[model samples]
Target: MLGAVVAVNLLDAGYAPYRGLFAVNIALVLGLWLVLPWSRGHRGRRLASPAFLVATFALGLTGSAGTHVPLTLLAIANVAFVFGMRMAAAILAGQAALMSAIPLAVGRPMADVLREVGFLVVFAAFVLGMVASVLRARQLAERVRELTVAQERGRMAAEMHDSIGHHLTVIKMGLENAERFRDRRPEAAWDEVRQAKELTAAALADARRWVRALRPLALDGHLGSAALERLADSFSGTGVAVSFDVTGTERLLGPDTELVLYRVLQEGLTNALRHAGARFVRGSLAFEKGKVVLVVADDGKGHGQGRGFGLSSLAERVEALGGTLSSGNAARGFELRAELPA
Candidate 1:
C-alpha cells in the first residue's frame, strides 16, 4: 500500500528527470521483492537490509523536489522492522538530512524542506517505537516457553525417580537376598528370585506407561545400582567378561547426583563396547567419606583425542551437578571416572 502511494505521487508530480525516476522505480521494485517475506529468496533474505537502505536513499534523492516524502518514510519504517531501533534511527536521520539538503541546494523554500523532513522524521520514530515493542514482546514469549519446558522436565524426572526407582530398589534387594541364601535356603531363595522377576516385569510396564505419556525419568539411589548391574550383564552375552564392584557403605544421594553418576557409567561402558573392543571391563561405584566416585575401565585400545556425543553428554550432566568427570588412557586400558559430593 505504501509503495503504491509513493509510486502514484511520483508519477503525478513528474519532478525528477526521466532517468532518475526510472532508477528509483527499479530500486523500489527490487527492494520490495527482497523485503517481502514470501518473495524473498534465501540469499535475498541475507541481503535485504542493505538493499532496502540503498533503495530508500535512492528514492529520497531522486524525488527530493517532489511531494513524495512518503516513499522515504515508508522505507524508514521498513528498515525499523528489519533492524534494531538505534540502527533504524541512524539510517532515518541520515536520509532525512540528505533529502532536506538536496531540496535546499536546488533553491527550494527552506520552510517547505523543513516541514517535509520533520513529518518524515516523526512518522519514522513512531514506526520504530512500535517495532521495538513488538520485538520485546516476542522475546518475552520465547523466554516463557523455555521456562515451561524446563518445569515439565523437572516434574517428569521426579515422577520417574519415585515410581521406577522404588521398583528397582525392590528388585535389587530381592536379588541380593536370593544370592545370599541360594545354597543354604533354596526354597526361600527361589521365592526371592520369583519376586525379583515380578518386579522387573512391573518396571517394564511402568517404563512403557511413562514413555507413552512422554515423560522423562531420572536414575536415583538403588535404581542407579541396578542399572549398573544390568549394564554389566548386557556385555556378558557379547563374550566380554564385565565385572561390577562397589566400595564403602551404601548411601542415598539426590536424584540429580544419582542420575549423573548413572549416565557417566552408561557412557563409559558404551564407549568401551563401541570404541575399545575390550575383552574385559571393570566398573565400580564407591561411597567415600565426603564424596561418591564411579569408574569404568576396559583392557582395550586407549582413549581418543576427541569425545563422542555420549561422553560429551556425560561431561555436561556431571558438570551441571557440580561434579567432575575424567576420561583418559590408563596403564593397561581406557578409564572413565566421575566424582561427586556425597
Candidate 2:
C-alpha cells in the first residue's frame, strides 16, 4: 500500500519541475532496499534501521504536500519490530516534526505544513497497527508449536513406560522367583527362568517400537479384540486369571481407536500384576451407536495412588480425540474406562 501511494505521487505536476530530485529519490530507494531491509537480522538492524530512517527523511524533502511522507512507513515498522512500540512511537513523533519542519521553514503555508504532518501521522498509525497484528499472530503460532512438541514428548514418554516398562517389571519378578526356587524347587526355577528369557525378548522388541514412536508391533495385523486377548494371555502365566469379552457386534475400528483399547488393557493388566496382588482381571470392549467404550476391571484391592505416567498419557490422548476417560473405584473393583467415537 505504501509503495502504491508513493508511486501515485510521482504523477504530480509540481514534481515534474524538479526532475533532478527524481533521480536522487530513485538512488535512495535502491540503496534502502538493497542494503537496509529488516531481513538483515538484529545484528545489523541496530545500525541499518536508523540509516534507513535518515535516507527516508531525505526522500521526504524532495516534494511538497508530504508526497514522500508515507515512505517512512517501512522504517517505522522495522523499528517497532526490532526495538519495540515505545521507540516506534517516538520515531513517529520525530518524523512528524521533521516532515512539518521542512515545508514550514521554506515559507510554505500553514495548510501545507499541517498536510505534511497529517500524512505522516496517518501512515504511521497504519504501519503500527499492521506491525502489531503481525507480531501477535507470530506469537500465537509459536505458542501452538511449543504445545505440540510438549504433547508429543509426553506421549512418547508414556510409550516408553508402557511399551517397555511393563515387561521389565514382569521380567524382574520372574527372575526373583527363579532365584528364590533355585535350590528348593529346581524344576520350578527352570520354568521361571525360561519365562523371564521370553519376556526379555519381548521387552527388547517393545524398546525398538518406542524408539520408532509407533503403536506396538503386536497390533500390526490384529484388530482390537485379538490384541486384547493376546495381551491378557501374556499375563496369564503370571498366575492371573485374565478374561476378555466383547459385547455388541464386532466392527472394524480405526488404528488409533484399536490402539487405545489395547493400551487400556495392557496398562490395567500391568497394574494388576504389579500392585493389585489380585488373581483375576476382566476386560470388555463395547460397540454401540456411534461410539465404542472399553473397560478394564480387576478384582484387586484398590490402591489410592493414581500417578502413573501411562494413565496420564492416556488421559491426554483421550481428551485430544474428544473422548472421555474415567478411572477410580467401581462397584466391583478398580476400573479404568475410556469411551470414544467409533
Candidate 3:
C-alpha cells in the first residue's frame, strides 16, 4: 500500500516544475516509512514519525495541493497505528492549517480552502476509526490464543491425574493386600504381588500412551462401553469385583461426552479402591433420551465426601459441556453420577 501511494506521487511529480525537490522529498518519505517501525534498531539518532509526515506534506506541495491529500492522510494513518490517534489528530490538524495557509497565500478563495480543510478532518476521522477496529481485532485474536493454551494445559493435567492416578491407587492397594497376607496365605500373597507387578506394567504403558497422545491408552480404539470394560478389568485382581452394566440401546456419544463419563468412572473407582475399601463397585452407563448418565456406586462405608481436585476438575469439565455431576452417600453406600448430552 505504501508503495502504491509513493508510485502515485512519483507519477504526479513527473509534470511538476520543481521535479528534483519533489523526487528528494519522495525518497525521504519512503525511507522514513520503512525505517520508523524498526527505529529501536537504529540506537541513538533516528528519524521520527513527524519527519515522515513533513516529507509527505512537502512531496504533496511539489505537485497539486489538495489533490495529494491521500499522501498526507497516509502519514496520519502510520501515526495512528504507531503513535496512536492523539498524535495522528495533532499531525492532521497541523497539516490542515498549513495547507490552508499555502492556498490562501496563492490568492485562492477562502471558501475552497475551508472546504478542503473540512474534507481532511473527515478523512482523518475515518482513518482513526479504521485503525481502532484493526487494533481491536488483533487484541481479540491474541486473547483467544492465550485461552486456548491455558485450556490445553488444564486438560492434560486432569487427564494424567485421573488415568495414572487410578493405576497407581490400585497398585498401592494390591501391594498392601500382599503385605497383609504374606505369611498366613503365602500362595494368595504371591498372586497379589504378581497382580501388583502387572498393574505397574499397565501404568507404565498408559504413561507412554499419554506422552504419545492426550487420549487414554485404554480408550485407544474402543467405544464408550468397551472403554468402561477395560477400565473395570484393571481392578480384576484387586478383588473389588467391579461390575459394568449398560442399559438402553447403545448409541454413539461424542468424544467429549465419552471422555467425561470415562473420567467419572475412573475417579470413582480410584476413590473406592484407595479410600472406601469397598468390596464391590457397580458401574452403569445409560443412554437415555438426549443424554447419557454414568453411575458408579460402591458399597463402602457411607461417609459423604466432597469433591477433591480430580472430581472438582471433572465437574468443571462436565459443566462446561452443559452436564451435571453429583456424588454423595446413597442408600447403597457411596454413589457418583455424571450426566452429559449425547
**Which of the numbered candidates is closest to the native, going by highest lDDT?**
3
Q: Which scores better on lDDT, 1 or 2?
A: 2
Mark the regions of model 1 whose C-alpha exceeds 4 Å error after superposition: 3-44, 61-71, 208-342
Global CA lDDT computed for model 3: 0.76
lDDT of 3 by residue, 155-264 (tens): 76787787789989998998899899999998989999899899898787657544534447356677779988787776666667899999999998876677678778
Of the candidates shown, which would achieve the greatest TM-score relative to the real structure? 2
Over 1-342, each residue of candidate 2 has an lDDT whose tens digit, in order, gives: 345535655667766666577557656766765766453255754777777766666665565334455566777787777777898899888767765787689989999789767766787788899998988887896796577558767766766687678889998999999999999998999999999999998787556444433445265566668877766666666677989888998788876677667766777777776667778898888989989998889888865767566688778777767788888876766888899898
Q: For all candidates, what are the clash counts?
A: 0, 0, 0
Ranking by lDDT: 3, 2, 1
Score candidate 2 by TM-score against the native. Answer: 0.53
Give a tens-digit lDDT track for model 1, residues 11-88: 655654554675656567565755543112344474566565565556544554343455555555555555556766
In order, the Cα lDDT scores of the candidates are 0.70, 0.73, 0.76
Q: What C-alpha RMSD separates each model from the true structure?
A: 19.0, 12.2, 13.2
Off by over 4 Å in 3: 1-17, 28-52, 100-109, 186-194, 201-342
RMSD of 3: 13.2
